[model samples]
Target: MAGQPTYMLGNRNKSSRTRDAQSINILAGKAVAKAVRTTLGPKGMDKMLVDSLGDIVITNDGATILREMDIEHPAAKMVVEVAKTQDDEVGDGTTTAAVLTGELLAKAEELIEKGVHPTIIASGYRMAAEKATEILKTITIDISRDDRKTMGKLVKTSLTGKGAGEYKDFFADLVIDAVLSVAEETEDGIQVDVGDVTIEKREGGSVLDTELVPGLIVDKERVRPNMPKKVENAKIMLASFGIEFHKIEKSAEIKITSPDQMQMFVDQEERMVKEMVDKIIASGANVVFCQKAIDDLAQYYLEKAGIYACRRIKKSDLQKLAKATGATLFQDVTDIRPEDLGSAELVEERDISGAKMTFLTGCKEEKTASLILHGSTTHIVDSLKSALNDALCVIGVALEDQKIVAGGGSPEIELALRLSEYAATLKGREQLAVSKFAEALEIIPQTLAENAGLDPIDKIIELRSQHEKGNKNAGLDVYTGKIVNMLENNVLEPLRIKTQALNAATEATVMILRIDDVVAAGSRKGAMPPGMPQPDMEM
Candidate 1:
């Protein structure tokens, strides 16, 4: 019934569009996987990324590497999205997600060439992914939420090869405290909003100088030098009102019958600002944080009232202060009450990197916290922050889910073993696809071994043998290049990390495999300047 595929019916269109989309996409996926494969385990190497502006970033993080890269291929970009989704959902295992997705597509492409339909391969992959998830549950080890030591180990595992090995213990403590500080318990489970942990970077000092503040820290300096430098037992007032005069909407010159009339009008504007300042003073607020600008007259009055004030504070900082200090923000300054005011044990201005910053310390609320990140250079600090984010996210998810699995490539190998056994129970072409899925998952351990400078073939064989011998937690030890108990070594990751990785990797692979045709329109004329001719284009 077919004279050829519809994508090939039109001679001109057929030449422009890629007919073998499966092969093209699989190659693109494999290309992207190779870019990040070397950055896998404890001994993994770092990628040095440079932008057009000559800004350089060196790291082994999969999310950062993909984000910084200038990827042109559409299929490769989709693979990059898998790492992004994994980073967003679980904050770790981004490399595993991307590599697994590429391997899945690579295996499926082989099946397609062997006369298996893409839909069949996709369904097999979907079923295998589900089976993999079920197998994950069998290997996960329950971790007590009360175990800080083990939790520290979990965060350290995330930070091991992230170029923070020296400060793993130090950073782990801060990350755990920061996450737990903002973690909220809901009816469904533990809810974590990492945004509650404010990270302010300053280029000075060293990494060891970084510490956690019990409250929010804003980069804003005091509005006036005459304002108090430090206030003990500070009463904080959060005012959303723009502590300034409202300019007349229309530009008009008022006819003054006399100088007294003009003076009265001028004095009235001053009175309005004075009234707002008096309201704040009456509320017993020793420190004022404003989201909007403060009129010069208001500043003069506030300084005279012996109150410290900072204007133009960011809205995020204002909300964080509200949570940390138990303060209520007021729309109108006149309606402020004592209960509406927040308090900090001491509100002081400190000189950080030669710039003044306000620190609200010893707040009553544990719902918000801040980390002052310090480093001798911006590059180190930036990479350190990314590493910390991964750790914080993983710990948050682990505590929320209350479960973890052995890291160091153990879980993937274990899943591969279980999936292969399950695949043997299937029949037909789907069985071949399922078996491919099992083989594809072994890439994690293999890459880990290769990155750690060990023989991947030998390592994978050793891992398979250990699992066959009923060592469920057996995994590749990158440091020793042997199969050991990952759980006993405390190489653990959050359960959602693996589950989310599987879900994302499978979704991306299926999406890529089902693409039978790719049609690209010629570049727009307006996209280039006039008189510039386009070169020979190909899909």
Candidate 2:
């Protein structure tokens, strides 16, 4: 507590009297929603979001777009969380979830001002969400295990409008196969534990040669060069606990009766040490993980024979190593490596537990070795460990999830659609929240359209009108916009105009109702800031 602030919030106000300001929060949440929903389908266009730093990100991925945005309103942050939650749950469909949530919030705001309580709006929304999920499930197609064609379609469908390249089918199939190999049937859902499937790229290594190892392998050398350079047909012993070198009785001390007796004691010690070494060699274990000290003579003998001896190996690593190597591991070192050396880096000898491990392999021979570290700080090790974990997680995701779509604007459009549907079901003014949410979804497509030198508002209107007449698709249907499609008489996917119109109108209404205050914290006494003031803020 010494370094902590004695009185935090010293200059901060505990309360504000802005409730009477009669301003509606334009619902940054709603805005985000509107921006995302404009590009809901294949017809969807991309968004170009440029931040204050002039950094530009062009994407339609809802999660990425919101993440990149410079949002200031606290309410909008809640919308962002909705997207985050979706990402956590499905690892995909985040944009769709977020756009829906934003539209819901926006519609709720409108109905709230129309004398409807937030509770009713929320209840209805909960019901609708459940219904929507049910609807999706009904429409969801069942894919056959043998239907490689459909699988290809699914992958291709997932990759549509994604990064372009050659050999996409090959890559997709490879990813799919890897994922399918680990797929496990469970009662709740299909479970695939991909934590161990690592996808790594070396500077000069081919992707095809990537393989899995039973245990960890590193590229390191023995702790000491003086230790055995190599051991032939070696018996390996692994242990997680330490041991004692000298034995003692219940109440024994250093009190020798005679010089002869003392000499005998010394000889006994030497015999015990020699017996231990002989047992290891006889057992055919060339590698031993020792938790205790080794006698100088035994160490010298082992070193001369080119046996691998490691000390202070972590218990976790030992267990994994043992499992991989199939070597006999115990608290005591009497057992040796069995007929099978097991697929392990090496049978290590160590005292400590909870240390991360990497096995170093020989370039020519796949011989396992250990690098006994001497000195290092905690931070350096921890950082390295974290980096490894991140790398591993990314690789695992790639191996397991098998796909990643463009984020940012793509998701927002979906959110808008879901929110617009909710708005339609609302009974009263609280539906305004859903409307606001829908409006928020439009920002991206509109921005994109505007940037492309087209009339975004007019396009929105056209899309909305077409969508209202039971058109299932409208907004960003990209494929239908092609010149070849026109010649081929390819009919465009119908747009859901009613929902789009509702989203746009509600956003406009909310934005107008919300523009009550124009406080510029940086300006005072009629003085302007360095840069040109916001056009909207100018009186």
Candidate 3:
């Protein structure tokens, strides 16, 4: 009994050690990758994801699809994280990252079955990722922030293969203008905050009616109907304080012996509200954006003063207002001064569709821009928003980095070709991993061809021939099933998108490959605990 080895784990715990664990994890990672594989390229299809509550999201965006899925497998979730990272870093190429990750795992599975250690495969992947990144730098073409035509091409490339592709030229110009409006030239480089470009959507109009506003649009209206709907030469006061009488912070009880005391208290409250409103008026701010509530008494005073005010504004919108109008946000009404006000040429409340919204245009600094997207239905608007977001992000990345690359799967095919050649110079099994990495990249073009109803095998063969002939920019033209120079076709994207996707995919694959054990504690749903005896119901 003493020599007997004790089980280190509790009976409730379940574990899969070594090869079994690796197989399970690899399978899970591959499965997640496969889920979004078909959603790649210009001819890709969309996925309609419906949650338990019956709400639906339809999109071909890889990150959206993965985010909407209720994935439970731990390894699969890691793969999903790859897509998320790609989205956050570049806002596009999520599907390529996911599909490449899956292919890497699928190829690694072959090596694993052939007795190659997981560690060897992982080391190979690391080396291959580094080499691929180096290769990307060589192929990237220099871009300038002032080159609106190329930037628009990059935006259009991103918007393609989705719902907004039909209006890509329109959306592309809108996105480029929106991004550049918020862009500031810093000592480091041209800095762009995509957040400064607000996208507002309204249903009932055609998509062609979408227009960019040179200022900010707040989805709120003036607090009082009698208030002036429009203010010219708007001096805006952004306030975080409520224009209401202060409420008791803690529980309190006051005994009133007569109606005179109650009347006096009411008068005091009115005076307090009036004083707060007076502070706003003294600041010479004709338009007010408050982060908190406005009392009815205060509203009456503000309306009487001919001030257009909106109450209970979102903190984010208030911040944008400060940037757009060159104003300071005041935490206390007493602290407000004329110098703290932000100026706008015009502030007007307009009825968009059936809802009232405030539009602040011709701001003093013009540091923010807004796109009012129009569509006939909720779904179309949502899809358009997604597409435009990707476009804006890529354009921003291109401006900041000042580097662009040909799209339409051109980069992937070229990277695969060069990586294969580089793999040949590497020693030992790492070459296999590097070569496999190259092969994995071809999946992008293959999937593109497949989605477009072309023969993937033949297309890849033709693409390889073109690359072999030194056509580095050659990519699949999905519509015509021809291998064309993407650069000549004006299919372009930011270099950041390709580099980010490669890094995310390779890192995720390497992390998954290094796992050789999985110890799952607690019984899974509908599954029995380990070492538990089965119930005999046949008796």
Q: Give lDDT tens digits, candidate 3, residues 1-539.
A: 88987667665555666787778788888889889988888889999999999999999999999999988888898999999999998899898889989999999999899988888888888898898889899889999988888887887788888999999988877898899899999999999999999999899889999999888899998899899988999999999999899999999998988999999989999999998988888878899999999998898899999999999999999888988899999999778989989999999999988889999999998778999999999999999999999998998899999998888788888889888999899889988888888998888899999899999999999999998999999999998989999999999988998889888988988998888766555565534344222322111
lDDT of 1 by residue, 1-539 (tens): 67855433222222212335667678889989989999888888999999999999999999899999988778899999999999999899999898998889888878877888888888888999999998898887777667898899998999999867779988988998889888898899888888788888899998999989877788888899978899999999998878988788999888989989999999999998888888888989999999998999999999999999999888888988898889999888767998888988888899988778998888878677888888888888888888888988998899988999888888888889888889899986788889999999999999988888889999999999998999888988888887899988878889999999899999999998878666544334323222122223332
Please list the Cα RMSD from the true structure of every candidate, rounded to 1 decimal place: 3.9, 12.8, 3.6
State, as a TM-score between 0 and 1, how close model 2 is to the true structure: 0.48
How do these models rank on lDDT, best leading? 3, 1, 2
* Each model's lDDT: 0.85, 0.45, 0.88
Candidate 3 Cα deviation (angstroms), residue 407: 1.7
Prediction 3 TM-score vs. true: 0.94
Alpha-carbon runs more than 4 Å astray in model 2? 1-13, 16-77, 112-115, 159-167, 187-189, 204-539
lDDT of 3 at 403: 90
Winning candidate number (TM-score)? 3
Better-scoring candidate (lDDT), 2 or 3: 3
lDDT of 1 at 316: 82
